[model samples]
Target: MTPPVPAADAPADRRRELRADCSACAGLCCVLPAFAASADFAIDKPAGRACVHLTPDAHCGIHADLRQRGFPGCTVFDCFGAGQRLVQVAAVERPVADPGVAAAFPVLRQLHELLWYLTEAAGLPLPAPLRAEVADLTGRTEALAAGGPAALAAVDAAAVRAGAGELLGRVSAAARPGGRDRRDADLVGAVLRGADLRRHGLRGAYLIGADLRGADLRGADLLGADLRGADLRGADLTGALFLTRPQVAAARGDGATRLPAALERPAHWGAAAPVRTRRPRRPGGRGGAAGR
Candidate 1:
């Protein structure tokens, strides 16, 4: 039997930085963003309007059955804990119907996404010099996030993203030396099942709807890779660098898929069998007859 590989564990601060805390949030994602009728959404909603599925208590009415209710897009969308922070910044206790708050959502979302990447970069095993640089970047971004709505809205988001992207690019290069430079490659609908992509640099690659089943992706850098609708069933992503929860959520996978430790298996991935232990089974055991 293969030894169980430990899932990637993020530092607590970084984990909190990346994961959504909906209870503390004001249902900003449901109210602030617009949606159009598509495969991902069942109806069209204008910005500043609460989603039809949003309940009175700021919970998703179909939270447990989002995918079954034609809202897989909601399942895949993550604000990296930005929604709550935006609510706090705006001083609102619950979902606000104000247009200004709605307008600031996109900007704050981008800033928080930057914070997510920078926070992740800080936790990487980079050289001391690079680590210090990452820390500085993270601090600057956090300061910007702490600024209220007006300051956040005033930010040049595009310029900030570009600057942070450069630093993250260096971090990716240092982490995965000699990896393939496949950034922004258009591989949509490409059939790459069972390909050996170990240690490849796939940053910003457009892999929409790509068939990656059973592929070997060990140690590959997947930063900013567009994995939406990509088939990752049974793919070995052990040691994959820069793979985020949002990226994994956007892709389709199965129980056999191997993922890094930091990400949870998407619920859409069918139920996985419980891991077996080394203990021998007792006589007439529920699992088997005396370890047959």
Candidate 2:
């Protein structure tokens, strides 16, 4: 049976910074990224090519009606400045060039992903040691942002990741709930093997590394929640609402697991039941491609 998606459980105070402040950016994400066919993306797009729906000024052409037009994936992507940083400093000469112009685009993508995680870290509670680490990394990342493309390309990604990882480990440890606190709390890594957490308010909670091997999370609210590293080996998330596909991709589930209707099981978790498939034919056939 198809399970219902959980309602959002994220708190109002826990709002993510959309960084719309980045509007001044040259629309690097719109011009330099690639996407394949998936639940989130309805069509394929080549790198550096402006999404067919992207406007001359780099705004989404369908900005006023994305969901109505079946382009929800655009809503979930977060660039974290990788696109802008690359374009401004790395390829300053290119004017809205193709996605392939920046050799460091891939590297920038990784850094931006890291930045996403670190940005979330800025909000979590942390110990003094971890907090200190977060401050240092945040400062360094900010400095790197101010540094031009050459400096960004010269960044040691591994070292930055290590520092972020250390701080994240601490944040996860500190954020974990204990004993009955686990009864209705967000357990990022609580070692619960068979807990029942159904119909609870888990909005915006962290479930990373939680041992939900046999837990029951059916009918739970999971809006805007982060479930990375969560183990859903034999757990039930059936009928959980508002659990987006990208959120599902971030978790680890197994064959015995149950998922919400709108999401597909992560490949690492096992082959999920196929929901839909189409012939290799493009959406519009060979004549011409559809707009983004």
Candidate 3:
């Protein structure tokens, strides 16, 4: 059995810098995606239109109280540094209305996400050949993302993503042999507390609202898993593969939740944290309710 790959220090730093730099960004996320009034959003926002809460200098007006104000989606949405990248590429004071900027934003966003995964995959304990392949792909994706808006628009992001996904699958299978295959399973709201899920294949699994508290998920391949609202308190995710920020941000993890070193714990998980080995009941009291 291949030993679990600890998150590599070099790549982990790269991944941290890969996340959204809101201060340098011009609130592209606030204007790029449409927000239909729903559970996550409180208003109907048209595509390409600046959100009502967006300040003139491109900051969210109600950032501190987004969830309480009925915009929980805003809390979990991460652009993976695409917003600032766009601003740098365009060099324009306002990028919200530029058709080229608008078109390039999404494609660059997807590429940057792939870059994140590829960066992590490159760090895994794979054979030399696979490692080389990961490096090659990373270099190519970086080159592609470095292009100006016109070059970015010319990119076929879907095709690139498809190839990357396939390669990543190979990397995961090779790195974590004998993992259970549960790709694309619909496990919404399933109670799976304290389960031994080591090396499981959970790619694209619908784990929405699933009770996974204290689950042993070490080495599980979680590529594209829909982790929205999943309870992850006390869970051991030290080496969970392909785990992305958006998935973790959408989930309900606590300070006790062990994540890959590359990931930042969602602030809503708590303002502070301490490692706890023991499993506790769905916590409450002074803390808000947990487990959906």
Highest-lDDT candidate = 3
Top TM-score prediction, candidate number: 3
Model 1 is weakest, by summed lDDT over 10 consecutive residues, at 1-10
State in Å the error of residue 39, model 3. Answer: 0.6
- Each candidate's number of clashing pairs is 3, 14, 0
TM-score of 3: 0.89
**Residue 183 displacement (Å), model 3:** 1.1
On a 0 to 1 TM-score scale, where does candidate 2 land against the true structure?
Answer: 0.50
Which should have the higher lDDT, number 1 or number 3?
A: 3
Clash pairs detected, candidate 1: 7-261, 8-261, 8-262
**Per-residue alpha-carbon lDDT of candidate 2 for residues 148-210, written as tens digits (9 for 90 to 100):** 555555777668766765565454444433312222356678887888876655656777777
**C-alpha TM-score for every candidate:** 0.87, 0.50, 0.89
Kindly list the per-residue Cα lDDT of model 1 for residues 3-119, writing each as its tens digit: 322333346776676578888888989988889999999899997889988888898988999888888889888888878888887888777777677666777778788876776
lDDT for every model? 0.82, 0.59, 0.87
lDDT of 1 at 174: 74
How many angstroms is residue 208 displaced in model 3 relative to the true structure, after the best TM-score fit? 1.0
Sort by lDDT, best first: what order? 3, 1, 2
